[model samples]
Target: MRRTARRAGKALGAGAAAALLALATPAGTAQAADGVLSIDGTEHEDPSGCFPLGDFAPPKIANLTDGTAWIWSGPSCDGQVTQQIDPGTSAIGRGRSLYIE
Candidate 1:
């Protein structure tokens, strides 16, 4: 009886750990609103290409200048690439680039 109880306790502990891990994992969705970006409930800004860009339901650009522009590449949380509009400068939008790099 004691051995059975010990085994049951161990199993319960393992199950609890697994549950915790599942809860800790990030969600597969992202949220964007009012020009703000978020991923798995975490606020993010100027995220790198590796970060999920979330649903591309719509494209919005912020902080535009004569030589810079931002573009949304897709309709899903794939990734975004930034391109330079000028031949030698990192600025974008001057060359009328259709998409990000």
Candidate 2:
């Protein structure tokens, strides 16, 4: 019984660590800023042209099975931006404009 309890505790700890890592890691759609734009004191790269006022960082991006990804700005923010990129594309270069709506 003691061994079983230990195993369960270890499993729970592992699961929590995995969840924390997932939250800390940025998604594929999140492009790291190249010190170009600054918004709300956070350096962000806005690929979508919608939020032109300043730089904005998306909380997370959802990967769809149809080769498209959905970028979520925030938990309460209703607006979402979708980006279409080539399958081989990985990173966005500096001075490049991302589509925003």
Candidate 3:
């Protein structure tokens, strides 16, 4: 009985650690082909074309597509284009425009 109780306690501890890790990890918008675009903190998932981002540039963004994505500094797929971001990668200074092709 005592050994059983100890094993249960260890299992609980492991479960708690896994939960903590999941919470600490940044979550991506799963399986989005076009990825999720954040313009001035607003998230846009999937589809294409200019969506009128106004003047607010995105300070950070994430690539939630199945493949890789490119983030640009300016609108209309122009300006400082970032390197290919794999799925689920996120960071700051990703600029305003995002295109996944």
Candidate 4:
């Protein structure tokens, strides 16, 4: 009975430690995209958050990531949404910025 109790306690402790480790580690959910976002001919891998074009509005934009994003007519992801680019797709427009989710 004592040995069984000790084994159970050890198993419980291990489980607790594993849980703690899992909590401490960063989750993959924080990543916005899992693939690439091509702007013009340039490629951005594992893109997340807002991407400002900054003076250059490319005519061709591609979203090869596993996520969707919006092409904005202005910078900072605030303003008119020119287009919504989905995964494995592309758009032909003059966009000043891009926002991903």
What Cα-based lDDT does every candidate model obtain?
Answer: 0.38, 0.38, 0.64, 0.83
Q: Mind giving the per-residue lDDT tens digits that candidate 4 earns over 1-101?
A: 99999999999999999999999997766666988888777888898888877675465878889999888888888889988888999887567888886
Score candidate 2 by lDDT: 0.38
lDDT of 1 by residue, 1-101 (tens): 99999999999999999999999999775332222233333433433332333443322223222222233343332235343232122322221212321
lDDT-superior candidate, 2 or 4 = 4
Please provide, for model 2 over 1-101, each residue's C-alpha lDDT reduced to its tens digit, 9 standing for 90 to 100.
99999999999999999999999987766443222232233343423332332234432222112232223333322245333433223332121123322
lDDT of 3 by residue, 1-101 (tens): 99999999999999999999999988975444666765446777774544333355445656565656676667776787754557787766445656664
For each candidate in turn, give its C-alpha RMSD to the true structure in angstroms: 10.7, 12.2, 13.3, 7.2
Candidate 3, pairs of clashing residues = none
Q: Which ten residues in a row are the worst by lDDT in model 2?
A: 59-68
The candidate with the higher TM-score, 1 or 2, is 1
**Candidate 1 worst ten-residue window by lDDT:** 92-101
- Candidate with the greatest TM-score versus the true structure: 4
Q: Give Cα distance to truth, residue 63, candidate 3, Å.
A: 1.7
lDDT of 4: 0.83
Error of 3 at 65 (Å): 1.8
Show model 2 residue runs off by greater than 4 Å. Answer: 28-101
